[model samples]
Target: MAESRSKLVIVGIGDDGLAGMTESARRIVAEAEVILGAPAMLSLLDGLSGRKEALEPDMPAALRQVREALASQRAVLVSGGDPLFYGVARYLCDRLGKDQFEVIPHVSSMQLAFARVKESWEDAYLTSLAGRPLEAVVDRIRTAEKVGLFSSDEHPPNRLARALLDRGIDYFRAYVCENLGSPDERVTQAELTDLASMDFDPLNVLILIRKPNRPDQASRAGRHRLFGNPDDMFAQTLPKRGLITQAEVRSIALAQLDIRPDSVVWDIGAGSGSVAIEAAQLAYQGMVYAVEPEPADVALIEANAESFGVPNVRPVPGRAPEVLASLPDPDAIFVGGTGRQVVLVLRSAYARLCPGGRMAVNVVTIDGLATALETLKNLTSEVQVWNISIARGIEQMDRVRFEAINPTFLLAVTKTPDVSD
Candidate 1:
């Protein structure tokens, strides 16, 4: 009798029940002396000789039952759709050693939901609401192109839609897919506002597709502008005027950063967040952290971010080196208004920047410029410095006179592939 193999079989079934399972999976389920599943999953099958156990809510009790059953008889654990995809199979396998069981998967409900809506989910953000906070999930969905959510009674589609709407995220078209793979399956499409007040079946997948070209509509003034817009174009703080970076220097610094569409950037000592805002625009698909210690400056950054409709720029309030510890590592960093601690901040940022990333610093004093240049030279061989002096034309009665703007120095460097190099 080959010593009676004691393998436990885990099969993924669907609303279609036995008809949905493969021949091998069906045979495994039929031969079992004991089976475990949620009440809805167990209700799908009939006329089986196995003793069925309801596995919802009281999972620990069900696991104990499965363990006792496996001691003397063949056991099978049934689940809806792919058992490995946000299902109980992973938990079971983790608790009951991998060698003791065999897993067979079916098409996941997320896959079915996308298929029903005729959309590709190759890059969709997919997650289950069973144990996640609604706010955290909504924040993740803010910039997603497509999202698939496994909703529970506690966090249903309507509740999720209302949360999203409250966050000013109304750019996605909503789809509620119910009873997937069953004869009475339904997929309902509606705008986010409409979906916020509607009801859905307990067994449903929520799909959100971002409206076509809607994400950028808030910021697209005319033609796609990446960086180096006029300095006056940004909202500056009152009374602390003339502190923003000039357009000429901003252009040079931006070119030096060599930002990609998805590059992560940090603008340290962000005064009124002009550089940070422009960097945010250039790195539209990525995130930009504007680290400013002053409360007023932090407020200005947020106001400017809203006015420009750039959602990716986050205004961080705190002193540097300490604050930088909490922020994500950056592909590029821009330091301005470092006061007398220019070298300290520069060294801290340099230590955290990713390899091949760039840093650009603006200085008006000779002492600040010298310190930055010296520290950057020790980090990499690809260091460049430029002295930017601009002159604006003023129309007189008979002629145009050019008045020179104050001179500023910009020091830019690229980190080596490794510290040893």
Candidate 2:
């Protein structure tokens, strides 16, 4: 986990200039002693003047400048749209610890694009072509019914359309929403073939809605397994399916825990026990305790463990804090949705985390994020935070679209080592 560096503030801006920014965003920018952004982004700050520095064209130079500005003064790094969604926040947070900065987001252009087409975006597969590889999103698009893509100067609408056509998977009706929120904004409706032949404004959103009655086809790759296998791959019950620690999330949490092959691990609020199972995969020689309260779910955990064929995981049937007492000290710990008692569970779990070990907690509510941060920060300074928002693409009624998992915050910290040793 990365250590907290500076208390940096990042504010998201939109095309409507400062008017588009929230009152909170405006105030943060106003109070900033120094502001840093690209030339075009800085141009939007017409009246709300501050000592602003235009970032250098080179990415490394830009990051260095941002680090310096943030470290030296009350600086705001301005970006367009929700900074966490494929924006500067993810990049910066990954490099510098998430606890170092505060993020304020604006309505993203991707959201506006979905709105312009009058399509509800809750199920749309959204992505940006700015830095993503073409092949990566192509297979996903082959199965999706609706997609909202942020087109870049390098991978514009025409090129994207052409690539899809070459794949022999062309059922989408296209909409190019250009220069959104500007006076000269345009929305061009066209077929896939028409889209392939024409140019679009560089600043544009490409929306793809599948033609009606189109059936889904399996990707040539088959149901490729993810590191933290998909939710369905595990044997989980109905309402519990929704409650299971998500595959990608557990993968992240496991990474934060830094579990080694011989590490003794404890998973509080283990739920369906996917996190414990995956941890068992890594800690093949180690022991993983799946601590759950419900008896039926405890059986499900054992079943899932058997299916994975990992004998290292033990399902402990009882509530946390109390059940935690019987367990051995842990080299690493993972706490899932323990709800209101999360603080209690974390306090007890942290006590068992061996010195220089790691603890990672996953929470869904703002209160959880705050209280978890407070509890962990009281114990260790090597704290890192991540806000994960993800959508999974699944086939429905022979067509594919995304099912969004609610936003989650992951907080991980490293316990300090004992000096006497």
Question: Largest TM-score belongs to which candidate?
Answer: 1
**How does candidate 2 score on lDDT?**
0.82
lDDT of each: 0.83, 0.82
All candidates: TM-score: 0.59, 0.52
TM-score of 2: 0.52
Q: What is the lDDT of residue 38 in candidate 1?
A: 86
lDDT of 2 by residue, 191-235 (tens): 889999999878789999999998765555444342478878788
lDDT of 1 by residue, 1-421 (tens): 5566587778999899999889999998998888888889999989899989887565456667767766756888899999989898776675556667788998998999999999999999888887454544676688799999999988999999898887688999999999999999999999989998899889999999998887622223344256777777777777877878887888889889988866789999998888888887777656789999989989989998887767778999987877887776688999987766777888999987877789999999888788888888876776789988889999999999998888999998887655232
TM-score of 1: 0.59
Candidate 2 residue spans exceeding 4 A from truth: 1-6, 56-59, 217-421
Task: Show the lowest summed lDDT stretch of 10 residues, model 2.
Answer: 218-227
Query: What value does the lDDT take at residue 190 in candidate 2?
Result: 95
